[model samples]
Target: MDDKSLVLPGAIFALFSIAMIWPPDEFVSAGATFEHLFYRWIGDFSLNIVEYQLRKILVNRVCVACLPALFSLYIILNVPPTALSTFVATAGLASMIMGLAYAFYTISTNFSQTRQVKELALYGGDVHRLMTEITQEYLEFANFAVSFAHSSREVVGSHWLIHITRFDFTIVNLTDVVFEVVRSATVDLNIERPNDQLQFLIIEAKIPHKNIKSFRFRVRTDQFRDLQDRVAAPIGMARNVILHQSLNERFVKAFVSCIDKNPRAVYSRLGELEPCFGCSSEIPNVKIEKRCTSIIEGARECRQCFCRPMWCVGCLGRIFAAKQEQERPDIWLDGQATCPTCRAEFCMLDVAFVVAEESQLDGNF
Candidate 1:
């Protein structure tokens, strides 16, 4: 979840309460109590839903983040000023109560969506249409920075595909090229949750292509290339979308703008708003989607854009491996791990492939 969204509600509630209390207003004490009660209620709600194991999570969030805020109040109220530890403990307790409520809020919101999807699906309603409506009305009506996709994973829930957006598909496939070179990234989601819905969404065109499609790539937390050195392409935030075949047409148009400029151009130059941080050996290629989007260009070039795979089906491409993908040429080679077509020397990662002959050392060891 984006930090901004998570904090918005609480910030609003806190500020509103403060506004009423300022300048010795009529509601100062009431407003303070209201603020406390509101947050505490949210904390309680979250705690109420927590299972035996997940309860710890609620406590941790309260103690680590929420408690500090409350302790500030404690320092101001204590006679002769209590010890820092006293303040800390009181704040922690207060924050825990508030955090519990927030957790409960989250659980309720998630559960509401799950129920909505289940009820809608049972009636044979269209998941995509519902997703579009919810995203437009509830998710990103004002915040273009936000986008949503409908996705479901077999783990932890039923066929719930409703997720808020920030998806991108085209850039992901391009990134996969680098991932394959790094020798990391095992396509486990494909094997484990074959039917999970995954969509890539891009917000307004900060990078020129609006309505970018979700990066319909599988998450492979297991595979790690150069694990010892932490040398691999940056993994930007990617949500788990239920595996889907087709994406929205508006989404397609946005992605389409980023594709080949020339008939010969294979790979698409998809861009991203949120790139990874701290690592610089490899550039943030911001990947793309393939399966959900049509590949006017052939395999090697097409796969460079994050080509999403179909349900229970996968492209045995080299994006996850060092070997040449049998079906497609290495158009997706924009990673730090030099591509097979390296003779072009800085061929610009998003450009079409220039197939080079296999060169081997004079003698094999």
Candidate 2:
């Protein structure tokens, strides 16, 4: 695949904007210059002077150079079946005559225009939105691969000690306009032990497959911070994009639709809730936590405690014994419920008392 590039559209937009404002043929043809120029030059002096800035060297500088640069770009973007023919012919015409003349001025003064031509030579110079997109992609790739080994992390196997790696980025093939391939990179992932300086390493970068024409890339960290940052993050995002699983407008609407109805699940979306299905049950259509919101966060107890159903009979029996103990002047802890994780005993009756007390506050207020 081609590497990403951003030359074509920028060149086209910039050139075309210049062309539409230029003076006509009679004014541009050397001898018939200025005061005898086309009617359009009369109103916009700034626009007129801009067209003639390089005219001393090339009389039809803006017209001959910019128009074809633009029209070639148009053919590149418009991409009609016969558009390639237009671009090849127009680019050839633009290059031979005034191309060098305009390019010399562009390079000597504001050189961005000259670089665009170089990018065209690499990426086929057709106006395309893809140029910007591909450039952004290469930048993102560089942000990861540039620092492949040395970010910071705890080397888990070595007694949970912290360590940082050192690395550097190098570009290999800026020549390939289509794909900005970094041919070599060096990374050092270990801390220097006294005089035992850590050795730097060159990663054999393996881009899976690419198709790029022109791209601008920036150097970024090659060292990784964590396992997910190194491995899972990139693959997961790519997989989601490939699967068409973006959380866009349609997904948002569906999520809102689910939230409004109040389903049995705390969160309407799958995978959002932190749950233990081993502790959950389907008790007909009974909803849990109708009265107390606190139940959602910590109260692992289910429908029985909420509704005081048959299963809660075991708890009620324990509470009854404790109540009897209170009447007989004997100290006793309230109904005990065992926590499954820690096997710790909790006073279920005390929890019920707190819930009842909180509910009473609402009435008093």
Candidate 3:
């Protein structure tokens, strides 16, 4: 038998046994004691019920529930001794009626809005809306960048496309003279639980080409805020950086060394080839001289200002460090950094390392 079934009968039998087994003289005193205890239990139960009803009324603001509760309280306070039992029973019945009525009202309201509830469940409600808004904003930024890149024919060398995803961005360099080079890189904005804040992940890097690698960095709120401010403002001068061959070589060496030490950090194994804007090398080459890395690692580049002289992570890091030294040499502070070529503010952490080919990393070997 279920516990409830056994427990219910057991309780009843115990109460009956207690009543039947008492001695005659002691029975009278026992009856008085039992009556007192029963009244006390009833009072406690009634108080708890009243407390629950009041809390329900406050939380739900159900006018129907409030009226019955208030009437019950009034009857309890004013009803004469002769009619106390009847009034108490009436109050309890009112409370029950009100509870049922409130439940019915809630059920009917939910049924009426079934379509809306279903839609919200399917589409993720607020989360979906947030994603849509972010996508639209990024699209507008990309269009503006593309337009600017086209207008400044001399400074900009390639057409770029920025693909917006839910949590990351894929930037593809679309300008290739001979054939379309699938040279692309990904910057992951790691939006954690609650999705309010974000971190950066470099999923792919193509410029100043080195092996594909991943690097993580922390993002500051002010730096994020600066990026947002730029998008909101009128499109201004597109920043372009042209890196010399000597500097490019130095950066490539640093990148290769880092990759050698941390082989697992290189996430992509794509064997794609693209002429480095800085060193004129087909990236992901065994030779560091031929590999080129993109200028802005984590930040999306403006298509109009995306030009040659791309630098690897090491070069960019040096430049950033130098700028910091020049600005505030004594006090160390990690704040917003801008592209040397374009003067556009970006989160350094979001910059990714690039590999020439992505398919090779698919475990074919």
Models, CA RMSD each: 21.5, 25.5, 26.1
- What is candidate 1's lDDT per residue for 266-317, written digit by digit as tens? 2233232222222222323322332223323433333333332111101111
Residue 258 alpha-carbon offset, candidate 1, angstroms: 26
lDDT per model vs. reference: 0.31, 0.31, 0.35
**For residues 1-365, could you state the per-residue lDDT of candidate 2 as single tens digits?**
11112347546665654433343454346434423343343333233221222232232344445445644554556544354455464664666457667646664763334333243334345423433333343433222333222222122110111111211111212222122223223333324422212222221223223232222232222122222233321312212121111112223234233323432212122223322222122111111233223343443532233322221222233333333333331222222344333333333222221112333433311
The runs of at least 3 residues in candidate 1 whose Cα sits more than 4 Å from the true structure, single-residue gaps closed, are 1-82, 104-321, 324-365
Q: 94-210 in candidate 3: lDDT tens per residue?
A: 775776676576456742333222322333446335333433443342232311111111011124323322122223232211111122222333333222222221112232232
Q: What's the lDDT for residue 149 in model 3?
A: 15
Compare candidates 1 and 2 on lDDT and give the better one: 2
Give the candidate number with the greatest TM-score.
Answer: 1
Using lDDT as the measure, name the better of candidate 2 and candidate 3. Answer: 3
